[model samples]
Target: MAIAKTSPSIKYSFPPFVPDGARLIILGTLPGEESLRLQQYYAHPRNHFWPLIAALAGKRMPSSFAGRVALLQGNRWALWDVLEGAERIGSSDAAIRNPTPNAFGKFFSKYPDITSVAFNGQKAHDLFRRYVIKPGIVANDRLTAIDLPSSSPLHTIPFEEKLAVWHDRLAPYLPPKPQNRRAK
Candidate 1:
């Protein structure tokens, strides 16, 4: 009798956080173990994603999940994953298999104002280029892909360096500094 090999379970990505008037959509490969457990994107404590967003927007980092979501949405930013689901025993993108991309065609149609698709890392960018560029899926005339440094602690680039890279490439799409409102 031969012993059978078992494959990893299929992990599903979280629903997108596309808000009204969203102009930019940030895509990660998929949420990691911690994120999945927390049911939030980039939930890992060491992840630099929230800090980067706060720094870029010139705002204090929001601590609560709802507050964080509001911060990004208020800035006209959306968040999602490149792969809707993938089979992987671990959180490593390299180990991902049987990947299925999100519904870009319908998403693009519904959210026609989105001008930029920002990938959180090289893997996410590559996957988008490979799977999300189907006919009528992306409005090429309006959509531009922006490569962003990964906020994962596993990524080698330093936090400050990553900030610089994102500031350089994504300055236009990132949320601008909030205006101060004086009491009337």
Candidate 2:
């Protein structure tokens, strides 16, 4: 896919933060308007991203931005988007254009500890194939990329179903929480 030319009316920026010491990097397309306005990742109220993450971790929903960041960091999860910047009319992934993709290689190089990478949805997976992954370029010992279900209300699947899929895909990476351990 060819990159679209940047538009004068469009303004975009990368997520303001990322988790340190992340073992897995999770990428998505550009943040929705709510996220941008809030200056936080997945801030849209209807978005299932945060709730799904909480379900997977078996924790109560985080009530604040700092709590959400802590939850991700505590789980060794890193968050960022595949597009460094893009022109778009709204939150729709299909509306993205002139995408200046993020330098994922740089992150992988710097955080050699990241062993697995997963995309938040089809848009990210497709973009990765078009821009990065399909190039046959590997960083820090050949990271594997997995396509995960979109944790968005736009997806028709029920919340429980989404949780099940995510739980299975993420199981290998998440260690058993203390609550799940049995007394020996």
Top candidate when judged by lDDT against the true structure: 1
**Tens-digit per-residue lDDT, 39-155, candidate 1:** 999899899999988887777999998877877877789999989999998788988998999998888888888878999999998888788775446655668889998998989
What TM-score, computed on C-alpha atoms, does each candidate reach?
Answer: 0.88, 0.86
Clashing pairs in 1: none
Q: Tell me the TM-score of model 1.
A: 0.88
Reference-based TM-score, model 2: 0.86
Candidate 2 C-alpha lDDT tens digits along 18-68 = 576678888888888888898888999988898988887778998998887
Q: In model 2, where do residues sit more than 4 Å from their true spots? A: 1-8, 16-20, 135-141, 179-184
- Computed on alpha carbons, the lDDT of every model, listed in order, comes to 0.87, 0.79
Clashing pairs in 2: none
CA displacement after TM-score superposition, residue 72 of candidate 2 (Å)? 0.7
- On a 0 to 100 scale, what is the lDDT of residue 176 in model 2? 61
